[model samples]
Target: MKMMERLETFLVLAECGSFTEAAKKLFCSQPTISHHIQKLEEQFGAPLFIRTGRTAQLTRQGEIFLDYAKQIEQTMLQAGSAIESSMKTESSIVSVYVSQYFANYYFDEILPTLHASDPPYRLEINAYCYEALKQALVDRKTDWAIMPYYPDDDFIRSDFAVHALFEDEFMLVLPPEHVLMNRKTIYARDLQGATVLLPRSPFLIRSLQKEMDRHGLRVQYLQMSNFEVIKQAVKSGLGAAFLPYRAIRKELEAEELTAKRLPFFGYLRQNGVLVRKGARFTAEEQAFFERLRPHFDEGAPAGRSAFS
Candidate 1:
């Protein structure tokens, strides 16, 4: 098989996780998919996948190969699109990366405006978290990344520029019937010896520790990643938790939960727009930034406005 065809087969197999599924995706027989993978394995002189029952997992070499394959695929597609754009005199593709939080909150408002604009162009958006989004920008895999403000890092800050979009504060959340609900403000001392449900991220854990240390208090922590699970845990009276104001606004308004002001500690997080420095932007991306500029300028007047 040709290199491009084999590469396509490998990518489909990786996505679907089985030869049968890959065959279906590629509109070919399972045997053909198997033959392509077998040829690839022979050329590389190593096993690419570890088969267990009906499932297949990528081996170490396969994992490394997959990354390179994706980069090559993206480059080839970009080159082809560049040729097509030159031939037809059309605008180029605009690729952007956004975190899951921002995508859920703001994508709907942004998409419609782009769709109605002149000189129609392609828009590619990748929803990724911290490290993946950072790498995408550093590798020039994405043109822009919409995410929370990360402290300046060598790979990211040197090559990209970030614009502050908006800031939001973390809120002290409690069940409606919790004792803290009656209080106008809650202090770190108020949470001493209490169980605090928090996300299992180093940044958050470290920040919490610093806050607790400042007040000379200690608390038990229930660490988990799923937001819904954390909410449920808190609602069951298992513990108190802190979340971004935007995340719990509906619950607070519905009176399902109550929030109290934090004392002395700001507990703020900023969201920013990250773009590759000196990277050329297509018309669509330029128009997106133009539309986005006003919202950031408006800032957090109420101290808890939703970017959505």
Candidate 2:
């Protein structure tokens, strides 16, 4: 608590830019604010402030420490909220980080149903791209992350406990009038000399590129991070893209876009749940994960792939 207090005080002082103003905001003495900053500087073995004019300015070291100070402040606030929420609701809230596509396609439907289930458990979903999702897991901001499996991904292999939920096969999406629209199976070479709309996330983008390059296909890209944006871009005839079938179920069924099976485009992205290494799951958390399993691959063909 004392460490948190010091950090909170430092954050206020940094924001207010004056010891007196910070003290006024905190309802503490100006001397106390000065003392707190001094203590932090001593602990870090550097000066935190440059005392000049009316407002105190952060030194180079203080600027670097500001980020950590802010993080500590946020953690403290979440901790307080958790305690209050537990007392009122008696429900444990689970924080989850989901990929943009998974959140839009599945979480949109899944959350409402979960909320109304018997013995309801609270779930908070934070949507991020692959890189941001990985960082959220490592930073412990989320209890679990729902993301796609990428080849040689160290986050899945080393730092987290993973469960293979289901496979979501990619569908090649093209405008209705495209040349490859009638093809039952498309090859990577078919995409050569064409612009492929893909997410800006490095991991997923790299995964897409690697598979194409494996088949000696070269292509241009119209890159955007969000699935909806890419879907719209494909619809606008920007270019063709490979996307999860579940995400574009309506579009596929409505014939808003044409989908072709890409035989040589062989990257089976397995979506899974990942938790920080060695974190023990309570019964509620375990049940929540179980409840979501059936909905994991809604795109699965009746007898075959999850993303049909």
Candidate 3:
């Protein structure tokens, strides 16, 4: 009996030209739809619809009133949008969480491009270590992430939504002066007895370890918490690292860090965007993603995980 409900029902019935179809759209019984239409007709003291055997046609008065109903609907939509925006402002914190290394290495250039948006919003770049980033998404402390892909798990599949951001491949990086850089084609034998720097993500570590064990390789590993640190360490001859090539391209171009042409054994890492399922992205969040979408233009993921 609410004004908007009655108006919406009338609009649906008019558009469908059938009481039965309107009932289905509105998820109500046909009689309920009919009764709603009847009440509106009586209020205006005019036959709004000419019901003829499961179909309805709007009369002249009904046609005239449809304009007013549409205007009301538009107004309601605007009002709802305004209310939602205001509510978001009152709670006022928009943030995208990711690994600190990703925030600096990957998104640093991509994020600054958003500075020209009208009615600017403050998007907090909440950076954390790998384990903390996963927990934050699971706990709903943050909504969106700009990070590498992780295989789906119970919490990820059930509670979070995954978006494949880009197809990335791991590169073995060493100092430019390292002996491995002189090799024409790097192989597993080249990495024998080397100290490999690794990120703290369990999934990546596990996947890499499995591959190493399968390949019958033996190497000393040093676990690092950030990509930048790992890169810097490799550049300083502290150790070598398997990092996403796209992430460390600047270092490659500048000849600061050297990438060995070792076979990764078809292990391609997929970068991804993770948000809590059913979370609404802010305007800035949507725009930031659109700018970065070109990198992820692999069409669709051919594989789910690095090894899978």
Which of the numbered candidates is closest to the native, going by highest TM-score?
2
Question: What lDDT tens digits, residue by residue, belong to model 1 across residues 177-220?
Answer: 99878877677677889988987655556775676677776888
Estimate TM-scores for all models. Answer: 0.61, 0.64, 0.61
Q: In candidate 1, which residue ranges exceed 4 Å CA deviation?
A: 1-93, 112-122, 152-155, 298-308
**Candidates 1 and 2 compared by lDDT, better number:** 2
lDDT of each: 0.74, 0.78, 0.76
Number of clashing pairs per prediction, in order: 0, 3, 0
Judge candidate 1 against the unseen true structure and give its global Cα lDDT, from 0 to 1.
Answer: 0.74
Ranking by TM-score: 2, 3, 1
lDDT, residue 79, candidate 2: 96
Residue range 125-205, candidate 2, lDDT tens digits? 688877887777777776577888675787667776556677777878888888787776666666779888988877778
lDDT over C-alpha atoms for residue 121 of model 1: 44
lDDT order of candidates, best first? 2, 3, 1
TM-score of 3: 0.61
lDDT of 3 by residue, 1-308 (tens): 47778999999998999988999999999998888888899899999988899999999999999999999999989999999999888554456677765776766666655554454546677888767887887777777676666674556667666677666677788888987788888778777888888887788888777777777779999998768789888877888888878768899999898885467454677667766666776555665565456545652344342111
